[model samples]
Target chain A: MIEFIQALRDPDIAFLRYAMAAGLLAGIAFGIIGSFVVVKRISYLAGSIAHCVLGGIGAALYLQQVYGLTWADPILGALFAALSAALIIGVVSMYAREREDTVISALWVLGMAAGILLIAKTPGYTDPMSYLFGNILMISSADVWIILILDTVIIVISMLFYNRLQAVCFDEEFARLRGLNTRMLYLLLLGLTALTIVLLIRIVGIIMVVALLSLPAAIAGQFCGRLWQMMIAAAVISMLCIAAGLCLSYSLDLPGGATIVMVTGCIYLAGFSVKALRR
Target chain B: MMPQPVISFNNVCFAYDQTEILHNVSFNLFEHESVCIVGPNGGGKTTLIKLILGLHHPASGSIRVLGGMPHANSRRIGYMPQSTHFDPSFPISVLNIVLMGRLGRRPGSFYSRSDKAAALQALAQTGLVDLAARPFASLSGGQRQRVLIARALACEPELLLLDEPTAHVDPAMEQQVNDTLARLAHRLTVITVTHELGFVSRMVDRVLCVNRTVKLHPTSEITGEIIQEIYGSDLKMVRHDHQCSQQGHTHD
Candidate 1:
């Protein structure tokens, strides 16, 4: 702990500052979006979208290696893949309600398989481990700026459409009757979830992204009486968990992403037990 | 001049997956008319309601609400789906749920003071004003149903649609809901789908017995024979007075 605190003050380890900043921003975004994801029962869809990011990362890596495409950043590729998957899933769920689960499961596995194939075909000795299990130490200043911009966009959009979003999430049929264009709202929500998943990938990676996205919100749901309160509580819980996880991982020489997810999961279980005991 | 009907369905036909639900269903509900749509399960009753709410479009013919298409006038039409569809464990307050009714009315992101006042008034109408701060999940089944009703009332709609409002409610609470509907019927055109014929209040101006087709009857003209014909069963009509007497006997 002493070493870690000293390292934070050391100018040589400036990446720690960026990592902490990224964690805070990602935490807030995940908390807000995750509340809706849990309440709307779309965690399964979120999981599918997270895995789909792997396909984009692999594709971008392969393209850059083989075609020498300098502009093809893996993060940009992941964003594109996440957004497309979100749109496809959103449209399918809306129009083909009966086959939604089957289609989502198919896409979920296909996305991962496609990612593995693309990564295998890449010429260079590319290590996909870092993408799968995130390394917060790998986050760059550019990545931090991307996260900040995405966070700002998400916060503004959520603030602007909070009531409409709540109405749609609570009862879509009623929202439709209110002339709220519920379909558009649902698409917008999925889009936001996609963006949030991208932000979380930096902190927890694709494999554990859904946990960070959902667990905090689920814990907050246990105590909060309102959606906004749940969002705020979840955000605070996420930040605390991330900070603790970061310190623990650094002290013990553990993997940062997995450690954070483990901390979040433990806290969620504790919260659930407390709620059950109260009941 | 006679006021335009609040809702009109002219030869509207709807089908699901090649199975016809509503067949040439034609009807008109005028201003301040309260109608009860009662039919057997899977008998196009919900289909009619959905059509009116613009959730489903007609395959043929026209359906209009408030002098326009159902979609065009959706803002003026308040809807309350069955309470069973709501997740009881969802984290929301009674007031927030009620305020959702004003989503269409509010021009801004936040609710205006008048919007809050209207929501509070709607809660008051349903006798839930005091419980505004209570978590919706903690409310009793009947209270939750009332909260949904309060949400519908928050729209300040000229036409109100309710589906199976008293389905899972106990008799006393059912009576309370019916009373609230009765009071609202004086101001808005109310359409409800219910199975409990005994719970139908005197405020119902008409009864539309829907099967594959719709048979409209003035409330005063409804008879047990007509109900039997509509249901295609020997179901008996239990009057509200008889239910009250039965409750009184149980108490005694």
Candidate 2:
């Protein structure tokens, strides 16, 4: 215990500490948004959007090569691509309800295709592993600060608009019948989802964003009945997963995001078992 | 003490894609009347309700409610949908469903203490005060229907619209709900779409029958011949047989 305490004083340990903190904060934001995602019955849509982030990163690369933008400026590129994907999904769903899922699938595949082709053509690609999953260690102080600020904004907005969101999720047609501007609310929800996924690209790889968003809330669902409690429980569960996964990665020399997702998968299995036993 | 028309449709027509359903139909729903819109399936009964509630716009006509366009002034209309496809696994309580009724007054606002009190009152009116703490998924069919009615009532609007409220419910429970509607007829204009010809017979002040065209009949004017004219030749025989068994009406 004395040696362990002393080991924490190392500069490497301090850097790892901040990385873990970033992961934990990212997890909380993911969990909070996830409750709504699951309740809205858009789990597949969440997966689609997360996977769709590949286009953003790919666009970032293109911008860096052609526009002479720094690699660090990829955040803006990611946001633009993410928002464009969101807009496409929205427009298709609005005009053609029957073809909504098909459009989403096409967008998802097109994004990945665009990403692979763009990256394949780019020069001097060195950060492949980090893009595939995540490298928490690569996160700087500025990245952590950006995530913290984004998380605060997400939490505050979600809390304030909780009722409108509930109305929209429960029944959009009924919400409209009662004179609520459901179309505007739908747009707002889509924008928020796109923004959150873009902000969380660093801590949880864009590929794994949905898993981090959905798993904790799904686990928390077993323990609570109300929306607010479910959100709180999901946050707590996410914190546990991030902390345990970070520590496990430190001890076992594994990928942090993959380890965290694995821990979440195990917890989900345990929740399933308990549910079965209760039945 | 019959109230004035709170909902009026003038030359109203509607369609889906290129196919028209309603064509220049006109009607007025006066307040303090329990009206049931009865028609065979696919006669655009549900579509009419949606148009009136502004869920869908009329293809060529005007629908006005409470002195304003129906879609623009939907805040004053309370609606209860058919409990046909509700997800039983949704994580909400009966009270929460009922509390949704207050959204009109405090649009996009959080639930205040006053909202809670009003929700409780609505649940109490629908005889679902005891189920306030119960999970919505666990309720029986009739109980769930009542809870939905409670949700609509929580809005405390001047017009209440219920679609197939008594469907899937037992006859005894159906009668109980009919009694509830009768009690509510005095306070607001109530419109229901129902298949329960026998059950709703006593409570409805007026009936609107729709085939390709809509025909209005006062409750006293209802007869087996009129039903046959609207439904077709086959239903006439069924009504003849059923009406013969009735103690109140003479068979033709």
Candidate 3:
């Protein structure tokens, strides 16, 4: 514990500052969006979207290697894939309500397959493990800036549409009757979720992203009565988990993303047990 | 001669996946008229209401609400869907649920002070003002139904539509709900879809029995025979005297 605190003040360890900042920002964004995702019961949709990010990463790698495109940033490729997947899933679910789960499952597998194929076809050795399971220590200054901008956009949009979001999440059919354009709002929410998944990919990796997105909100939901309260509590809880996970990972030499998810999972189980005891 | 009906369905036909649900259905609902739509399950009762609310469009012919397209005048129509569809575990306050009705009136992005006042007024009308701050999940089934009704009332709509307001509710709570609707019927046009023939009151001036076809009858014309024919089964009708007796016995 003393060594961890000493490392925090060490000037030589600049990456720790970046990792901590990324964790905090990701926690805030995840908390706000995850509350809606959990309440709306679209965690499956979120999982599909997280896995779909790999397709973007693979495509960017392929494009950069074959065509020598310097601007083929994997993150941009990821953003494009995630957004497209979100739209496709949203439209399919809306129009084909009964077959939604089947379609989502198909898309989930297809996304991972496409990513693997594209990466294999690329004429270069790529370390797939880092992308599959996140390596927060690898987050660059440029990555931090993109994350900051995305977080700001998420915060602004969520604040502006707070009431509309609440209404839709509570009752979509009723929201439509009020002339709120529910379909459009639902698509916008899915889009935001996709972007949030992209932001979280660097911290938790694609496989574990959904855990980071959902666990804090689930814990918060158990204790909070209102949507906004759940969001705030989730944010605080997420930050604590991320900070703890980071410190533990550094001291124990464990993988950061998995460690964070484990911490979150433990906290969630603890919360459930406490509620059970009260009952 | 008569004020234009708040809702008019002219030769409307609707189908789902090639299976016709409502065929050539025509109806006219005037202002301040309370009507009940009763039918067996899958008898197009819900289909008719969806058309009126603009959630579903007629396959043939035209439907109008408030002298305009159904979608255009949607703000003037309040709707209460079946309570079974609601997720009780969702994190929301009763007041917040009611406040959703004011979304139509929001000119700017933010809700106005008047919107909050209107929500509270609606809650008070439903006798849920004291529980406004309560979590909606903690409410009983009847209370949840009333909260939904309050949500619709908050819209201050001229026409109100409720889909099975009394379904899954206890007999006493059903009476309370009917009384609330009866009171609202004095000023607003109330259209409800219900299977509980016993809950019908004098306030419901008309009854539309639907089964892929519609038969309009004055409330006085509704009888056990008609209900049996419409539902294709022997169904008993609770007489007004029986309801009075039940109420008195319960109180005693």
TM-score of chain B taken alone, candidate 3: 0.92
Task: Give the per-residue Cα lDDT of candidate 3 at A84.
Answer: 96
lDDT score for residue A44 of model 1? 97
DockQ of 3: 0.73
Give the C-alpha miss distance for residue B104 in model 1, angstroms: 2.8
Report the C-alpha displacement of residue A224, candidate 1, in angstroms: 0.2
Per-residue lDDT of candidate 2, residues B133-220 (tens digit): 8887788888989888888888888889999999988876876687777788778889999876764466677788876567777766
Comparing 1 with 2 on DockQ, the higher-scoring candidate is: 1
By lDDT, highest first, what's the ranking?
3, 1, 2
Candidate 1 vs candidate 3: the DockQ winner is 3
- In angstroms, the error of model 2 at B212 is 3.0
Could you tell me the TM-score of chain B in model 1?
0.92
Candidate 2 chain B: 10-residue stretch with minimal lDDT: B238-247
For this target, which candidate reaches the highest TM-score against the unseen true structure? 3
Put down candidate 3 lDDT per residue, B100-218, tens digits, no spaces. Answer: 99996755667888999999999988888999999999998788899999999999898999999989788778777877887898899999999877655345778899999998877
Kindly report which residue pairs in candidate 1 clash with one another: none
Q: What are the per-residue Cα lDDT tens digits for candidate 2 across A177-232?
A: 77777777776677677777776667667777777778888888776777777888
| Candidate 2 B-chain TM-score | 0.90
Model 3 agreement with the true structure over A56-115: per-residue lDDT tens digits: 999999999999997998999999999999999999999995978999999998998899
